[model samples]
Target: MLKITDLHVQLEEEDKKILKGVNLTVETGKVHAIMGPNGSGKSTLSYVLSGREGYEVTQGSAELDGEEILEMDPEERAAAGLFLAFQYPVEIPGVGNMTFLRTAVNAQRKARGQEEMSATDFLKEVRAKAKSLKIDADMLKRPVNVGFSGGEKKRNEILQMAMLEPRMCILDETDSGLDVDAMKLVADGVNALRDEGRSFLVITHYQRLLDHIKPDVVHIMADGRIIKTGGPELALEVENNGYADLLEGTA
Candidate 1:
């Protein structure tokens, strides 16, 4: 569903390379997990894929399905079925959670030439999805992430992903701050959406998340490049020993 080839990205201001000739291909219907230590450019890869500012793609190409997405704006990428769950979900003090979600969903539908979802249908979906994520009505009425806990914010991100139902999901450290219960809820929500036509690119630092959301492939990234690709055992390897050996050329 997503293919990135020789993607060389660097900060435009600093000119310091973050992703050096990175190549990855996430197949349709498969879950691919990327595990790396700090400074491995893991989050940078997700940011670049999402078309965030401050980073320039010096070379290489990123394609969703068959169309190149590097030239598209962030909104275009979202309309094209690219979703990024941020590591730290920003707080919007003025907008209600429900309002924000409904706006985003309708915007994407409009972009795809589909009719805007009526308020009745949108409310039904919002309620149903919120229930699945254990989000209450009061939470929905509140401003987006305004007073939510870390776990709540992460679940909110998953809720957004579930509502939009993007074809390619890029989860950037969705497991960063969650406790056991919160992580399980987030994982269950994600697993429920697994489909033959949808794919996931889970970028994480730890294997605990992988235990809940098993990946079809595990990749070890280091020094701005993916150096090792293996099955699920690879995540276990990192969990048991960390990225030291992976970085020192032993593993």
Candidate 2:
């Protein structure tokens, strides 16, 4: 559902390039895992795809289901069915989790010219989703990730994804700081969202998460480019041998 071609991205203020000629395509109903070491531009690819500020696209193009998304704003990208689950979920001290989720859900609906969800209906739906994600009701009543633990934050991100139901989801380090139980919770939530029309691009360093998600394709990215692409076995190979072999000539 997403195609990126010869993508080149650089910081606007500093002329440092982050992604160089990166090409990738994620089809509907499949999960793609991007594994790379630190500073490999994995996160840069995510930010560029989401239309975040300061990343200048010096070259290439990104299309979401045949429509170019390189020039679209962040909100427009979201409204067009692109969702990014951040590596580090920010804390909103004053905003309750339920309130924030409702606002986001209704905002997307409004952008899509759909009727707004009433408070009662929204609560019922969100509560069921949160339960499936193992997020307690009390947690939803607290400020959005304000005082939550790392696992809590990740679970919250998945909960948001479950609520949004975007066509393509980019999960950046969604398993960064979670225990085994928490990881299973997040993975189950991700699997539940998978279907014939939905796709996922999971960016991570370890193979443990891949064991649960079972990606359809695995890509090795290094030094701002994807140098290798294979099946789920590629993730296991990387985990066993590290990125040394792939980074040698590529870097």
Could you say which candidate leads in lDDT? 1
lDDT for model 2, on a 0 to 1 scale? 0.94
lDDT tens readout by residue for model 1, 128-232: 998999999998999999989999999999999999999999999999999999999999999998999999999999999999999999999998999999999
lDDT for model 1, on a 0 to 1 scale?
0.95
Clashing residue pair totals per candidate (backbone < 3 A):
0, 0
Clashes of 2: 0
Q: TM per model? A: 0.99, 0.98
Compared with the true structure, what per-residue lDDT tens digits does model 2 show for residues 1-251? Answer: 99999999999999899999999999999999999999999999999999889999999999999999999989889999999999999999999999999999999999999999999999999999999988999999999999999999999999999899999999999999889998998999999999999999999989999989999999999989899999999999988988897677565
Worst 10 residues of 1 by lDDT: 242-251
Question: What shift in Å separates residue 211 of candidate 1 from its native position after superposition?
Answer: 0.3
